[model samples]
Target chain A: MISLQDLTFSYRKGHLVLNNLQLHFEPGRIYGLLGKNGAGKSSLLYNICGLLYPQAGQCQVMGFNPAKRQPAFLRQVYLLPEAFHLPDVDIDQYVRLYAPFYPGFDSAAFDRHLDVFEVPRRQQLHALSHGQQKKVLISFALATTARILIMDEPTNGLDIPSKRQFRKVIAGCLREDQCMIISTHQVKDLDSLIDEVLILENGRIILKEPVTRITEKLSFRQVLSLEETEAPLYSEGALKGYAIVAVNRREEHSRLDMEMFFNAVMVEKEKILPLFTR
Target chain B: MQFSFSRFIHLCRLQLAANRKLYLLGMAALAGMLLAFMLFFLITDDELSYNTQQTIYMIGLVLSSGVFTTTIFKQYAEKSQRTQALMLPVSALEKMVLAVLLTLVVYPLVYTVICLSCLKVMNYIDIYWLGNPNALYWLNASYTPGLLIMYVYVQSFVLLGAIWFRKQTFVKSAVMICLIIIGIHAVHSFLGRKIIGSAQPANVEAVGQKLGATGISNFRYDGGMPYINTLLTASAKINGKWDTEYYMVELPRPGFAIMATVLILVPFFLWFITLLKLREQQL
Candidate 1:
């Protein structure tokens, strides 16, 4: 659904932000874009949506060049940017004005999503709270029914219940033809949602694998003590116990901790990647 | 892909909604002016002469142009609101086109209608002339459309200025101008004057010859400053011998189309490209 080849980008001259990076994402899966703050995750998502162009290389969504920004191409893609300012008009007016621009805009679905979230459609968007505004944007994005949706830090302003609602709604609303690429530093919010992991570090994608493969090849555990004799693949001492991820030697399916897995990939990247190789 | 006229209209309407306050104010002022003109005509019972009407139109045009320009800066590209607009699915080209149509085409047409209505109410407008709004004496003769196009160019340039400098754009623009002048001189002092060599006069005879008598000389360059200077700098012997066909004022359709496409469309695309670049860096 998306591809980036040797994409190098920079803000100004002599300052490279994204180095020669290559990435690909297929449909029918949720991919988590993992990185620290300012790791270029948002940049990568924007590039995918053709909101940005690279100094070198190219980016494509579905089968079209995102930079070209053809109407048909745009109709199939959506980008929920970190910062958004909705028009001050009431929600219904906003919908009436913008719905015609998108060929696939589903007004009924939009209304349903709004009702599900219990957002007041008659209230002006600016009068709503931060979380409420987010719900509005998220609901509208989902209603677009676009093939590729790129969200950057979608769960940031969301409260606990709303975050769960967000995850649940996203998981339930997606179709097999749809591909959602979510970039977030908050990994636990996407624990059950993401099926694939795409870890970006030092301007390159260092790891890409499915959650199932990662779990089958490796294991995560909370050992009572850090003084265990066998050295684990990766370990960090937590307050309650030692959090460790190691090569799975037993038959049971170990619950994967997305945060621990991300740190393990960053720390023992070389050692962990080989285990997932088919 | 087929361009959707209805979609364009919808986009135009959205822009109108965004600037409803300005629109309401302009409309109210227009109504008040029309009522005042009608009262004057009714009390005096003297036909408002064509010259007076023309003068009124010109003044109205200038005043309204100023209003539209300022509003465009505020409503379309104010810095505080720009970050919120970067994520819409619409491309920069579409957004720019919508803005241009609203500020230039839609706003001007609405103003012209009000002017004609005022003239009609005052019994100063002829029914024959009413059919062709573009045929108004002052409007046609003064090239209001052409001037509006120029204003649009200036507005788009200022939009670029707004994007480049977040705070105090007017000051930053002055500083940039000073730097460019000083930097050019500094570069010339160090490396000699090979780059932007001293300005020189163009030979009208040579230009006319190259353009085949109807070339550069055939166009009337109304731009006062350097063009007037160039005319003054001409050799006495070469005066009147130059072909003047190209110098006459003509309909501004082609020029407006070309400049509007460039001034509005090019920066718009570049802005999108800039947004993308910034997005990557932000990530």
Candidate 2:
């Protein structure tokens, strides 16, 4: 679990990137962190990981103050940074060197995951292609079995097939006790994967809820016109007609369009968040 | 209460893996220089030769120290390595302790072993110097524990410089040098003016008697002793080489050395705290 209480941060004095921010994450689900280009998504991640200290307020992960960086605290968490340049070390050796630090490291699971990703255990990391390297890190992060896994842009450089592979690997390895929060602009890659969604905008978490609840509360459907049909919650002009998202009242729940939902949240944060909260 | 040696060794192994080639090359270089020294001393049969071997040795010491310091910093904050290091699930103390060990104990031990082995081989071939062939002589006055501790301390500060400046360590080094030079000049000018303007004749006589005129001169008395004196400047000038009486007055003591060790470790501890405060976040 992670919690941020009134956290405010700035790289320099008086320039707040995050202001009076409050957010919480709990285990048992994968959360997709959605934000615009400069929505302080990375900064929020950094604050949670204890990489950047808040100018005021507090950030805690799993009851441990990240700033303290206790061995026990670190052992329970893992950060897969966006920068994918690993040391020019072979995979097996890299595992040997780094695995001891994590208390619950599963070397067998790591080897199995390496096989799953088809990452050659003998090749140097730098020699791998971008997607291959990403797979290597993903596989390694999964193997660490840290209670909290924070991944930034996890699907950035992956090819179409590799992205699917990434989803499969993550889903297969996910433990109910571990909470994985991934920040990415590619929402489509995480469709049907992330259980919960947290949308950040303008230094605040404007929306946070489970996908099932969101789908039931809001419906995404293609419509012929912008005309009101039972007062749709949101409508965006599409090519053939107007694409609208309304509060779903039907007995059956439809699959949520992550990209459309993300846009809706970004465009109509105030309207959509209150509907879910109520 | 304290970090485990096993953990330290585990981390040290990782550091070694990061730059094994450079470390091996450093060991070879140190060994080569030691061999060259043995060759020179063997031919001359003199411990203190007229040649600039000692000067070369001093230069080598500075260069090696710089390389060692840079290596320590880069292993922790190397652009290629920093991200992964930050991702590791270990305390900042573990990272710092491992860095210090790599810089001080591990590298020095490797160099010492290489140097000693080369000397041993040379002695077997009947090309020995320093005459005694006591392998333990490498632990002479030059290899004092205090010097090693001091070097580690300074290197740890540079390691701190690496983290604090991150990618701008070279710039940090330059800025530090500039600041130190400016400070030295300021302090030198202030003390110079004060000592010359107000130094009393009796104070000079008293200093001369206590530390001898030679020792007092090393203290760099520019002229008349100042009446108004600051203890910091006077203490800075109290060296004993040229100031012979001061040399006798300020002999080394084990108690002071112990205190100095604690002083040297303070910066490393502070840097360790900084590392803890600024860890890599969850992605």
Candidate 3:
């Protein structure tokens, strides 16, 4: 679990990156953190991981102040940074060296994840392609079995197939006691995988709602024409029809289109957020 | 929370595993370079004194250690590396201890072995193979404790710089150390002149003879290392030629105490600052 209260952060003194934020995350669910570029998405991740100290306020993860970075706290939280450098060693050597740091590290699970990722277990990390290396690190991050696992832009650099496999591994590896927060721009890549959506904008998380609740409140659909439908909260034109995000007032069942929902939040910030607030 | 020997050892193992290749290559390069330098000196300087050989050894030791210390914290140099380093499940104290171990203890010990081994081989070649008229032997050379201590003292600043600077660590550390030394020396000189007088001590007769009048002679204040040196001069006839000798005399201690305390305590303070820097490092 993670909690941030009055969490103000900035790289420079005058400019605020994440301003007076309040948020909470619980175990047993994968959180998809969505935000625009420079929206403090990575900054939030870094703050939670204690790589960056907040300018003001508290960031408590698993009842420990991450900034303290006590060994016990660190052992429970793993950050899969957007850009990471793997050592110039083979996978087995890396595992041998680092796995002991995490008491819950499961070698069999690591091997299985790697198998799913299709990364060669014996090759030097540097020898792998960028995506393969990302997969390898992703596998390791999951295998650490940390209570909190954060992946920033986890799907980046992955081919379509690898991204799908990434989702598969993520779906399988998450334990009930583990809390996974994934920050990514590619919503579709993880829409089916994420249990909750955290939309960040203007240095604050404007939306933190479960996918099921979102589906319960709003309907995502495509219609060739919107003239005959009820008033839509947000709508965007597609090649064949208009993708609309409308209030689910009639109890009609519809799958949540994450891209449509994200667009709806951005465009109808005033109109759409009210539905979720209620 | 702060220090765990088991976790520290695990961290060390991880560091060694991660950098085994770099370590091996670095050891090879250092050995080659030291051997080459020894060979060059063995061939070029036939009349080398113990002083010259030891000077080379000390200089080489400090230089190589400075180089090594400058690179020991490359993990903190880049964003990606910094993440992995800080995220490792080891306390900041453990990481700092490892850095200290590698820079102050491990690297120095291994380097000394390599240096002495090279010197030993060179000495044999000089005496037995080259048949040199004069040969510098390691066993005969005596090192000044000050020089060896100064090596640790000087490299502490480099260690700090390596932690603080992201790039150009070695050169920047060297520059910073020079400036700090210069500043400390200036301050020490000014204070010494003020508290103890600017005049250099001379023998009693030259200053105006007083049987008990005494002040420190051969006084030294190099940066933070302050000393009250005493000199005794003696003359002995060897082969009908007089060889002059001098013996050092003791002096009072109150004035030197303040400076000595600060000077002696600074390495630990610098190391503490380095640890704080490591803890506060952000990416």
Candidate 4:
């Protein structure tokens, strides 16, 4: 589990990136953190992983203060950053060097993830292409099996097939006691995968709602005209109609359009969040 | 918060495994440079003077210390690499200790061996191939206690600079280190000027008791070490022979404690500070 309360942080002295921010992540869920550029998404991940210290307030992950960066805490939490550097070692050497730190590391699971991604087992990491190297690291992060897995831009630089494979590997390897938070700009990649959504805006996480509850409270539908409903909370143009987010007063069923939902939250927060509150 | 020997060893293994290619290549380059310097000396001069050999050994040792210490924590410099380094399960103390082991212990040892080996090789070439006798081979300059102690002492400061200045680590560290040494010297000189005034007068009285008034003119007195018994010894080649002109003065029993404290204690303390700085590092 991860918890942040009144966490104010900034890279520079006076300019705040995350201001009085508060949120919690519990086990048995996959969190998709969505944000625009400079929305403190990566900063939050850095703070959680102890790469950046909170200017004020506290962040606790698994009963340990992340700022302390104790080994026990570090072993349980893995942060797969948006960019990473791999040493000049092959897969086996990489594993042999890094895997011992995590007591719960599963070599078999690691191999399974690699096989799923189709990463070459014997290629020197630096010699591989960017995507292939990313795949290797992704596979390695999954294999660590850390309790709290925080990934930034996990789907970036992936080909179409590799993205699908990434989703499959992530879904297959998640344990019940694990909490995985993936932050990415590509909401579509995390459509059916993430159980919860965390929207970071204006240095705050304004929305942290589960996908099921969001669907239960709001309906996402395509309409031929704007006047089909009295007033939709949000609408965007589609091929022959419009995609709108409306209050699900009649409890109609529809799959959540994460892209539309994020946009709705951004543009129509006043009108949209009230429905979720109820 | 944990310190396990097994884990530390594993961390050491990881550091080596991660940078083995660079380390191997660096060592190879150092040996090659030493070989090149010796060959240059053998070809250019009648024989490779021990002084030139000592110059190469000392200068190379100092430069190598700065270079290696600067890179010992280069992973902490960039964001992407910094993230991986900070997220590693090893404690900061373990990381600092690894840096110390590499820069302080292993590097100097390996460098000394290479340098001495190069000295031997050049001596053999001078005698066997070039028909030059009295070729200087061994370099004992770096092995002296004073030089060894000073090397570690300066290396600790350079390591701190490396951690503090991420960009242009070597250049910045060198500058910062030079400034600090200058500052310390300035302060020491100021204090000496205020307290001691002129040491010549005190030595003049001692010289008057031993030799004539003109004998005081021959002796040039510098500041003495802050120990109980101070040696005012001077060496002069008298009557066509190198002779020791002993003028041992026993003032107190606080012999070399200040120097010992500065050299022995300060480096360890600086290393501890390095660990603290590492612990506080953020991307």
- Winning model by TM-score: 4
lDDT of 1 by residue, B13-68 (tens): 77777667667887889868765864574456444655556656666655565445
Q: Candidate 2 versus the native: TM-score?
A: 0.77
Return the top candidate by lDDT.
4
Instruction: Score every model by TM-score.
Output: 0.69, 0.77, 0.90, 0.93
Off by over 4 Å in 1: A237-239, B21-67, B70-93, B109-283
TM-score of candidate 3 versus the correct structure, residues matched by position? 0.90
Which lDDT tens digits does candidate 3 get at residues A155-271? 999999998899899988788999999999999999998899999987988999999999999999888899868889988999987989898998888988898899889989998
lDDT of 4 by residue, B185-240 (tens): 66645644454443444555555555433344433333343322343334323335
What are the clashing pairs of model 3? B230-B248, B230-B249, B231-B247, B232-B246, B232-B247, B234-B245
Lowest lDDT 10-mer window, candidate 4 chain A? A269-278
Task: For model 2, state the Cα shift of residue B36 in Å.
Answer: 11
TM-score of 1: 0.69
User: What is candidate 1's lDDT per residue for A1-278, written digit by digit as tens?
Assistant: 78889999877898776889888889888999898777778778777866677899978778898766666777788777777767778898888877776778888888877777778888998899888898888888888898988887899898888888888778888889999999988899998999999888767777788889888888888888767635788999888889999888774588779999998988887888888776
Would you give me the overall lDDT of model 3?
0.83
**Model 1 docking grade:** incorrect
Is candidate 2 or 4 superior in DockQ? 4
| Residue-by-residue lDDT tens digits, candidate 2, A1-278 | 89899999888786778889988888888999999998899899878877667889989899988876667776788888887466668888888888887768888888777777777777887788888888888888989899999899999898888788788888888898999999999989988799999888778888888888888788888888767477777788888788888878783567888988988877777778788775
